[model samples]
Target: MTEADFLQLPDLAARSLGGAVVYANDEFFASRENLISPGAPDFDPSEFGHKGKVYDGWETRRRREPGHDFAVVRLGVPGVVEGVVIDTAWFTGNYPPYASVDGVNLEGYPTYQELLDAAWEPVLDRVALKGDAANAFVVDDDRPWTHLRLNIFPDGGVARFRVHGHARPDPAFLTGTIDLAALENGGDVVACSNRFYSSPRNIIGLGRSRHMGEGWENARRRDGGNDYVVIRLAGQGCVDHVEIDTSYFVGNAPGSARLSGIPNGDAMSDEPSWVELVPRTALLPDCRHRFRVDSPTPVEFVRLDVYPDGGIARLRVNGRLI
Candidate 1:
């Protein structure tokens, strides 16, 4: 899948990141929360409730009325919708035959009633869906969205609903210095040298690492080279300080790390000229190391290099936007 595809982009409605299924027309057989579950759907043939077979997805009662069923989801972060996935795994006989998606942008916290009253624009028109399979649809809209409404023709079960897109941080909220390398702020790990065990993207995710699994980890390097990940900042900024955390990785943390930055639109060529923001410094396992940057250059990208390659729970580049 390409970067623009919803399957490749981050889920903006992930419950783990403060997203919520605000309202659903009906959920007789399954809960609406299941639609944004991070894990894959599971099945047990014998598992059945009074309503019907218990599925790991959103399942409404069989349509008896004239209208369709719908669910409203508040995005974890406002972003531009690029793609969507209406997964119907394990929902063969009871999956929705067709679906459509709509989005809306609103500021501040809004009530469910307010969301229902808002004017929602179409992200995906009505389209046919396959049973027991991931139904992916590419969206072309670039408008930032804060909420989404998924409409299912003639109510049925849907294993999961994933909305993927690029984060568009509000400039008003970015008044003070902040972590320019944060995922919620729009920073992304565009490229990495290695991701054998875990994804480098995790390092920039929201909040501190809960465990080693939530951080970036790579295989032990046998050769004499280092490991690195390049991150595109949410916007150009003058980096002030940096933090490298190795929490929960007591035994396999990098010994040292270095940080570099470059302006946006510059070619990231082999051995590209990188301005050293933080010199090679020693790191401790299960601890947080903070350093002040001496450079004052405005940069749109940052690269973190770990000596000899090991796990790094998180990397924070604190700065003020330029």
Candidate 2:
């Protein structure tokens, strides 16, 4: 894959999706919590604190001995990571010169001590890094991992850590009717016509978006056509219900929407490849539109089309796996 092709995959370590930095060896300069912020790191050259210049990232004190600095992260959606991104934005001088990553799998939440003693395997070996840049690495391990350990040479700051992969939720919790288009259920947005304001993948995120920025918003359309997003389902299933949430999108919600699916198909072709699940219907701003669908044909993919283009908070295709 290309250097950034992995970005198309879901980020299982997003704070918005429940990820957290469980532990850190030290954070005398900046808090470790900043490493997982959902938004990009912020900066203010004139912003200084009692310690030194304030930084929006995890910054440990310079080591005095022969050890290094490290932090542990609990992935929101336990999955086999395909790639990693160590973003050290705005940390030009204090960014880590090199870093490595390791991962571990466990049944339930392990105590801090137990996690420290687990047989963590290396996912990405030590690699050089440039300050104020997002370092990307594609790993080879395919085993599902629940946690990750980041090791920085000696000590320094890091803005963010992204684990890109698909979710591997426990099968027990996936029983009964479930959202076939949920990121936590292994579904992912594969393609989209526009993502100028926000990522189309956000529509598959859990719950209603807190604001317009949390959902997918395309730029104003000039091309006579509309906006659309294609999703690969968690598994082959017949859609039973659908939820289109436009919460917090007061003035920019889509005027109307249509849902279509491809039964017994593994790929997306032209419109002829899809069967109508929900016909184009009018939509209101900041409202939840729930529709009962009786699709009997098992589908592997689904598509949502918005007329002329606008914002969409969340899309749920509920069904049972066949």
Q: How do the residues 1-322 of candidate 1 rate in per-residue lDDT, one tens digit apiece? A: 4534456567888875668898998999999989998879999999988888889999999887699999999998899988888999998888899999999999999999999999999989999999999888888888999999999998999998988888887888776799999878888888898999998988888888899999999999989999999999988899999899989888999989999998753627776667899888888989988899888778988989999899998999999988
Candidate 1: give the clashing pairs: none
**Each prediction's TM-score against the native?**
0.95, 0.95
Backbone Cα, N, C clashes tallied per candidate: 0, 0
Name the weakest run of 10 consecutive residues (lDDT summed) in model 2.
264-273
Q: Rate the local accuracy (lDDT) of all candidates.
A: 0.89, 0.89
How well does candidate 1 match the true structure in TM-score terms? Answer: 0.95
CA deviation > 4 Å runs, candidate 1: 1-6
Q: Candidate 1 at 290: error in angstroms?
A: 1.1
